[model samples]
Target: MSVSNSPNSIPCLLLAAGRGERMRPLTDELPKPLLTIKNKSLLAWHLEALSAADVENVVINHAWLGNKIEEALGNGSQFDLNITYSPEISALETAGGIRKALPLLNPSDYFLVINGDVFSPNLPLQGLLDQVSALRSMPNQPLAHLLMVPNPNQHPEGDFYLKDSKVTNEPLDGAEKLTFSGIGLYHQELFKDLELNVPSKLAPLLRVAMAKNRVSGEKYAGPWHDVGTPQRLQELNAAHE
Candidate 1:
């Protein structure tokens, strides 16, 4: 669990386990993270971003077509990062997959996690790193800190509300309902009790933490794409082309 490249480095886990059912025929042959955009794999883009962020270690969890991910990324040397894979026989959703890979992560009390499907090139890791340091020093630490954004057309209702930098389930008077960017920093304790290899969703855990006022977040107005459908993927490629 000591994934640090140094005593202070924060390790990151990239989630790549979803079946991408909406992506169907394309995902039939390749995992969603392996789908290309502007000639680069989705996972590759994150790897490069992480490397640029100075995050030296990464643990990627994959299920469908997992081997091909290993084939394409190998040991992560190309990206100047230490890449480790956590293979799942079946997609274990979000929380379960994190529980399964906890042992492979840096047990620095808190660690970074990013969803592999979303494209948010500007999602700042340094800010998350600074948060990790500040939170660690607090006598009462929050379970997670999320990056939120205005509801995208695909998810108009949004997921949670963010008020004064706090994430909440209800639309509190001053809270702004927003969508989770799938980028966060979580304390290891959040997944400590979760059963490994079992399918579990992240929303329930986050909601529970929100009820306890243990979740915090920020709104990000930047380029982001979920790429859930084939059309979105095509649009991204076409725009770049």
Candidate 2:
């Protein structure tokens, strides 16, 4: 299958290295991404979405029950996608996992990154590309763009504050707060400062960049599900079914 020609035909980084401590027993048998929801693995849904968006290549970082994921998906050719696995001895946190897979990702264009457990409807890839293009057009501009969503029931306090489509680390004091939808388009240069193999979290990276007003975000008012706990997984299964 030929991928549609698009400026956002960038590769993706699927962060699947977490232990899925919240999804316990089910995770004991399979990785969270492999847990079935509506007769499809969580990772499968993500792959389909990426394929639809004209994304041709993906880098999957796996740890817990990692072999099962690889054995199931193989090289992604089944989906007409090329997949490269970044296997870690132990689960590296988000920023560290991304840093580990940096070599697999293109160091030129902006790439999409998403958590393995969260599920959202087809993302607004074109809209985000427009944001990236707009930012790149400006001199000394933002290098990261995030998809911000309304605070979900599980996280009422929210994650980040969005003002003028820009994300900030500062907590919202009696204001509408939104969560960082676990999806983002990031430029390769965003990780330039971090030395190779350094353990880190994505928040600090966003904070420094955001303080410089170099982080932009767009609110997504669409169907989004964070299947973190078994209860939530059941809810997602029932809802989607």
Candidate 3:
């Protein structure tokens, strides 16, 4: 699954609406995505990588301290991309946020979505881009292609099982369950049933798709970190330093 060498104008969504409850004092005033990892906010890391991957348009949804995100990366010009914000009155969880941001993410039938709090500095944006074509060509009419990773200690139970390259909610084949990397390329039909602006979780919607075998995924063994805690942030910063 390889994409053309010539860069294409791609659209992407960065989910940055979490309140970061576990990150406490650090996020008391600032949003979790704005937390600095190495002189760069976590969102900036994704923006830069997306820009390099030839992704020209980005939509970011926010609720807690969203203004700070706009102030930090206005228009995404500095990173060579056009930035758009889908502000929510309240944090609308994953599916809801994606629903709210849908208008801005339109025109492109398929788009890449990344979790704002994760610290996957080496996320394979180009690699994910490569799957767009396959998703379009598949006769199963697949609705989403996820990036899967080995479960971290905090979530050892894992989220879904990948067998025959298709994501499944159950271990039907006794395959090991893997954690969703919070990164995926999605098709609009997956959210066709979602009510716009209403809060919803992505897992339930994903489960529905999995039951129909409409979801596909690939394992990513790259360096990935769930920055859900202060200690993890400190460790990442220290490691990078």
Q: Identify the candidate with maximal lDDT.
A: 3
Candidate 2 wrongly placed segments (more than 4 Å): 171-175
Question: Which has the better lDDT: candidate 1, or candidate 3?
Answer: 3
Candidate 3 has an lDDT of: 0.89
lDDT of 2 by residue, 1-241 (tens): 6666776577789989888988998888799988878898989988888876678889999999899999999999988899999998887688888888989986575788989888886766566655656776868677788989988888998888887776788754443568888889887788877766666799988988988878888889998888889998898889888
Model 1 steric clash pairs: none
Any runs in candidate 3 off by more than 4 Å, and if so which? 1-9
Per-model lDDT: 0.88, 0.83, 0.89
lDDT agreement of model 2 with the native: 0.83
Candidate 3 residue-wise lDDT, 196-219, digit = tens: 888999999999999999999999
TM-score for each candidate, following the candidate numbering? 0.95, 0.93, 0.95
**Candidate 1 residue lDDT tens string, 1-241:** 1234444468899999889999989999899999989999889889988887788879999999999999999889999899999999999999999999998985768888999999876667776677776777766688999989889999999999999888999889978999998999899998877877899999999999999999988888988888899999999999989
> Measured by C-alpha RMSD in angstroms, how accurate is candidate 3?
2.8
